[model samples]
Target: MPTPWRPFASYNLWLQFAPPIGQERWHCDMKRGFTKARSREPLVATLLATDTTPQRIGLLAQRGVYEFHQDPLMLYRSDAVTKVAEILQLNQESAVVQERVISILKNYYSNPILFGKNIIKLSRGDEGFPEPILIEQGNYQFNLFAAIDCIFKEQDGTLHILDFKTGQTDFDRRQAYVYLLAASFLYPTQPAVASFYNLENQKWSDPITATASHLNAFQIEMARISQQHQKDLQRYRHSPSEFKRIFPPNPGINCQYCPFNSICSFSELEVSA
Candidate 1:
């Protein structure tokens, strides 16, 4: 009646397992263990449910953009930012969130990047999980998830997959590759390119395209990550006490910002002092 469960892979999972270029210093495998492996546990579940400030800002900013496009005329209004803030209830958020989100709304109002484009899809950012693209490569099968923010058609009839970002995180080309891979399956006939746009600074990345060989290589990589992650999870389940070993911790200054720092045994949040 229903399809059987399968391992999953996504840009987020890839980032968790392997940090982006130059960001390896802050990558912590144990954080992924707590997030994906032990997430069902009461304590970990509670911690995971909490939305950090950055997460909140990103969500609200995306909603703001969604609201603006909902009523195109609203974008032309002088009080466009104010109206979007009310819809987002930005006032209820912390001062920091309110300030940043309001600025993002203002930025979008002034520029409105997608204003006249043929936008086919625009996400509200709270749409939970997207339907996965089932990928079967030889004996390995897994679900590939790519939560694309927006997809619009270019004048040349190319499908453009645009991802919205916030804060200071650099654009990781791997994410664009994942989207391209997903697009290959979802819109096989259409030529596609992917790029990133930072809502806060209004920065745009160059459009990224891939060859058949590139997509094939990425599929292989995703298969490897999916299999490796499942094995790690299975190992953890058999021996819960071996979490640290299964997902080794890299503790240091970065632990201060980790959501699981308070509960992480290997956290360097405190010293002998």
Candidate 2:
């Protein structure tokens, strides 16, 4: 029989392992534990099942873009935004979700950045999980998962990987790095660059390119994180009661926004007071 599935690494797992620069105070390892370790627990499962407002809007906005490109004439139609809204069933969503998603649809319709491009891949954002890239360095091996949003070839033949954003979240350069690393493996001979575009505000990030050394460094970090996360899972299995010690919590004003806040005793004790 094939060996057991290898550990996995992704930009999301990297975020959970450590906070982005200037945002360390809001980092909570326990949230990672709740998400990756205790995800099967009923309460945690329920919370994970529900999409937060930001998540819902992002998904709908991405779907809206996909809908527009799905039909060549949809973009030119006078009721383009309304048709995408109907396709997205925005009427069923909450008022806030409806309003923001509609705005995003309008923004994309007005701009239509990807309107005419040498497109490679485009995701609707609801596709569960992407296929994993098996990576092996020496005896250390793990799966690297990169869910790229869109990929198109530039006029110069360089592969351009674009990630879409919604809301006020700043573009994390690390995410762009991960995309470039993934591209290096997926299209070894092709030069590639990554960037971010905010659909809500129409902000576009500068194209981010990485050197061979930078890609190697990212791979090393990804491998380390994969092994460490596997060790964490094993530790949790051995002593479930020591979960707090295994994954410490830093409860603060941000706890109100944590999905696990309702069940996290630390957040309940610290933030509620």
The CA lDDT of each predicted structure is 0.94, 0.92
lDDT of 1 by residue, 163-253 (tens): 9999999999999999999999999999999999999889999999999999999999999999999999999999999999999999988
* Ten residues in sequence with the least summed lDDT for candidate 2: 264-273
Clashes of 2: 0
**Candidate 1, 219: how far from true, in Å?**
0.4
* Top lDDT prediction, candidate number: 1
Error of 1 at 106 (Å): 0.6
- Which residue ranges in model 1 land beyond 4 Å of their true spot? none
Over 1-273, each residue of candidate 2 has an lDDT whose tens digit, in order, gives 964787999999999999889899889999999999999999999999999999999899888988999998998899999999999999999999998998999999999999899889999889988888888867998988999989999999999999999999899999999899888889999999999999999999999999999999999999999999999999999999989999999888779789888788888546455
TM-score top scorer: 1
lDDT for model 2: 0.92
